[model samples]
Target: MASGDEPSGELASSLRAIGARYQELSQFPTVTHAALGAGHATSAGGQTFPLYTECSQPDLARRRRLRFSRHYSVHRSPGSAVSVSRAALSAEIHHQLLGQLSPTGQHRAVLTRCPGLGHELLEVWGSTGRSCSVDLTALGKHGEVYKEGPFACLTWSHAEKQLLYVAEKSQPRPQPLFSWDAPGAARPAEEEEEEKGEQFLYHEDWGEALSTCSMPVLCVLDIEESSVTVLEGVPEDVSPGQALWSPDDSGVVFVGWWHAPFRLGLSACSNRRSGIFYLDLSNGRCELLSAEHRAACSPRLSPDGRRLLYLEGAVGGPHRQCLQLRMITWHTRLTATVLDVVQEPTDAFAGIYTDALPPQCWAADSRRALLSTPQRSRTDLLLVDTEAATVMNLTAGLPEGCWVLLTTQWDLLVATCSAPHQPPSLVVGVLPPAGQELTLHWVRAEDAPPVPGVSWKTLTVQVPCGEQSPPPCGTRAFEAVLLSPPAGAALHPLVVCPHGGPHSVFDARWRPTTAALCQLGFAVLMVNYRGSLGFGQAGIDSLLSRVGEQDVTDTQLAAERALESEPLDRRRVALLGGSHGAFIALHLLARHPEHYQACAVRSPVTNLATLLGTSDIPDWRYAALGLPYSFERVPRAEDLAAMLLRSPIAQAPRVRAPVLLCVGARDRRVCPTQALEFYRVLRARGVPVRLLWYPEGNHALSGVETEADVFGNCARWIIRHLGQPCRAAPGQHSP
Candidate 1:
């Protein structure tokens, strides 16, 4: 087949023969439709897991009836049995299928199915917790409820029985505003130029009275009355975090962080702080309860409505560096007292401070409470005896994990544990009599794809640095699943796949794209470099300013180690990544062009200055890059230049490898302008580069057509640049 060409019948037959040979030699398992069901039902000594899906005639019929897998399945019982209601069918399917799959009875159901909103549906978990659908499409456009799904929070008024929803509606071309409403409300007229001007005039005159100055307002919908009202207004400069309704639905609490302003002719603001505000729904009055707290976050109300439990500060920093479980008494006018503080001096940063604080739920008596301890490197489940002021650790051995506690009459907890290279599994257990120790019971283990013809091992090596102790580097080593071809595949190509999230570690999850690469004949090496989370704060801190230097060294070292056991074509190695991974790819091409034949980068950060200025997230640029918030308070130009030198765009001309840059036009996280500017510079410098822009995508390429284009183009690019024929020809598809 020619480059980018689809095979004809004759070519297909030839390719099939080649595929068959590899299939035989590699022992690639034939994955049939029947085999697609649950594999290897192993019990951890528990009741037979509730089966979520059954091999039934209805399932078969539904499968055959639908042309696509996205369609919903309809089941009919034999012998003309009474027809089940749609709700009953959904409940039965989830109960029988998911209940069997997961012993904890924890499953999510997507009820609303809107295609334009990309199957926008409510995701209902358990029987209570209701979260709105936050899918990009749903959050971006305003329209009818497109999909049917479970809701995180659904409340029907005891009086009105009307349903209120926290929803998004598209305004103009670029803005999405969160609004409060009930079903079947009349739509507001689109704001026109004349109307906008008049509104602005009115806003300038009575903005404060009407709460129009607020960027986003907290709203409450009285379902029975079909009335919507703004409960509170978010301050202009502060970024809102989470909002929660009071148990009685008479009040709302929201958390937000405000950036400290830079003083003229002085250093930039050094402190980052947040506050919790309580809004009275009856009167639209807002008051700050903990206005003095710095960096306090994740406030949860106690069961009795007498106290609040929250995390104070960033948890482990120069600031309040302790994870203190605080209690606030409403009787004391919302005064807070620190109850128990979790901190370790040996920890580079107090570990508990960085952990996320989940919701606090009460035990049956409402005296004992269960709350997730802030996750250290590993998560620890904690049972707090409120009256006794004592804390007990549960699930101590599980490292780098998360847990959910269901405080039903019987206290049941489900925990998921995982490490750098271990696939995660769900474990269920019950709290002991005294709520001290946990009685462990295995529930279900995640089924990881068996690695064919490969054995995997892990190794830690010391990377030497001049006059200093070499940084400890860890990697998981695995043999290639596909064997070399008869020509012995002597010059087998290698791929250096760096994961996104400079701080996110790589784990042993089943990634379809990664497996596809292996099936297409490539040896892939994924690296979890320094600054990755779950390894402790020191590891994460190491990558703060030294992003490219050490990470690149580790990547190169990993490649060298991989080459020791296999014959690799040094000249044919390529670097591929997305998001922050894309940043590393660009950095590699710029700093070590000769090391890679080509590079593919998606949604990469090109210019640090532009990134800081235009990123959707406020204060992230300053915090992540260790930069001052405002330019006026920044250091001298020389110092700024030194910092900017580390940016990818600055070193673009030094990139000798062919480049493929992909970006999403609607990506708010990493603006498309970054890619556009980088491509512009590369072309100006006469570098061989291809730029692909997806107008409909955001940070992720999700649509089927977009994903096909990305993968197909990437494969074709690799083959063309490496002097190999492509399976899909140019005219066959558009990249």
Candidate 2:
């Protein structure tokens, strides 16, 4: 190993190799968005239609990502149960951002962000070869267009004359501390006063990735009139978004998130208190359409426009939980009826676990909707009958992997499917008639180049049952996906990976890190321990209050079981994780020092007590410890002690493995100080440790260049430590 902070020659070589491998993987573009065209035709071979998909891939040369739409003639094969030929690319549209097709399909609305110029451009392109552009920043000083969260939306009116979207509410222009207006430039004293105090006033945003989204409001654009209007009647406390024009265009339906108690981290959190509401344009009245107290979003209207479908989960609980499908009947202009489509799961189905539904999810029948949700270790596309309250797994016949529903138009459905060892490939399927088993014959719309030398399988690890053992109420059995090179080779080094979210599940989908490591002859074990989602709410609730003990034990047991079962070198095992996963990884390293040769973590939760006051999701710290959170609740001595006791910092003294800490300096979810504290402890103890700080990276460290650097360095770190034998210190013992 190198004597100082700089990487060794071997480490540099491995980093370059890993970077090149990742760049190779980036060549396969994944389908990001799909839009079906107006015409639908049936061919004798099977079926054919015009499909438009927005594909994205990392442009390594430019150090950025490139997104473009491809038009294709998708043809399905009749001989196969459900399969499509790799459709030839018919046409390509480049430099389009957030394109929304009009109802009549004769026009398209495009919203593009020009960060370099510090503004946004909205363009409307008509089929007749005419297009108009509007500089949103200049139009009315409406804030940047929302690109994420429940507030992110771009929809067209049925008449195609208007467009509805969400944007941040304009803020008062800042004024000098002491300035006098010219004699001719007289301004109202009240308006001038409003700008004075706003210069440095504190304003809370939606949290993390949504830093600029402090106050979101619905906005409508009149194409012909060249005007933009911020819809009224929305309560000041409510942040309205996901707005869509109502059936007759008399009103707009939207989801409103209340900013009362406070805004917790909204990224990947689905249980924020919100509801579906309708804003009447004529009366300027906003009426709550769904249960006001329940958490709801993704208000999708049916094909016939008489029904409204949305998802609801319990409020003030887990950050993410199983959602209950619901449909509301628009009986009259004044009244509506609510129906519980899938309130709970049946024997075969687990529950609905999805952040959002596709924009074009409804089928031609107006009752069935296509949704992809986590089911165990894989994501399955399900055909949901809103009226019948029945669910069918549409992708059950596919290989054990993830099948994500992208969009649907008429009877046509588009999705991207992939396995742990495969890259994402676009597939198209036509919905079958109602009351029939949905054996969707999926046709490959776009093919991803096959990844060589990688193979994977799912392994089930049953939680040990005993009186002294932790309660097995939620997770009786968990699973892990192990990816490795082809068989008949030397036993490979193993990397035990635990996922963050403790509530989030690790799907058996293609990941660049896993692929790169597997290709480099390292077997990667991705453990979806007890607390992971897709197993059920019981499994998630089971780990509460038992974070360190239960999660640590579960991961250790899963790793040990894999070591015993698979052809992996027991002595050459390392740990890799992020956030909560990193917390578990550190615990495993500290408690079972002899088992792991090294450890690499990203923005780990080292000391929960210290993080409670710093993290954006302080509520998560409380919820993980089987406690509820409130802004008014003060942390007592015992609470802080309990938090530290369950955190990895308490066990840091026992950790002997060489460690690599990757942290984003700007991370708000888990502060960078958490990694620093751990690094200091390990360095003080004379443990070989290195910390890589990304100045501009956030909690996820998900930037294209940042991720490449992280993964490449992580590979180098693991390789260096795994090449040598790891021995525990004189006093340490495996748990």
Best lDDT goes to which candidate?
A: 2
Model 1: how far residue 549 lies from native, Å: 3.3
Write model 2 residue lDDT over 1-735, tens digit each, in one string: 222456577667666666666777656677888876575445665655567677777776778877666777655446423444435553444445578888766788988776677668888987676566788898765788887666899999988889998988887678766557676786656666656756777888877788788999888888898778988899888888888888888999999999887777788888888999998999998889888688899988887898888888877667888778777787663423232323223445777888888888898888788888888888888887776677778776477499888888767788899987678888777777887645556667566655776888889999767725565454578889998766654677899999998789899887877887887778899999887778777777777778888888889998999999998899899999998999999999989999999998898989999998998888888888888778788998988999999988899999999999999988989999999898998899899889999999899998778888888888888888886212111111110
- lDDT, model 2, position 43: 60
Ten residues in sequence with the least summed lDDT for candidate 1: 29-38
Point out the worst 10-residue segment of candidate 2 by lDDT.
726-735
In the range 659-692, model 1's lDDT, one tens digit per residue, is 7888888776678888889888888777778889
- What TM-score goes with each of the models? 0.61, 0.92
The TM-score, computed over Cα atoms with residue i paired to residue i, of candidate 1 is: 0.61
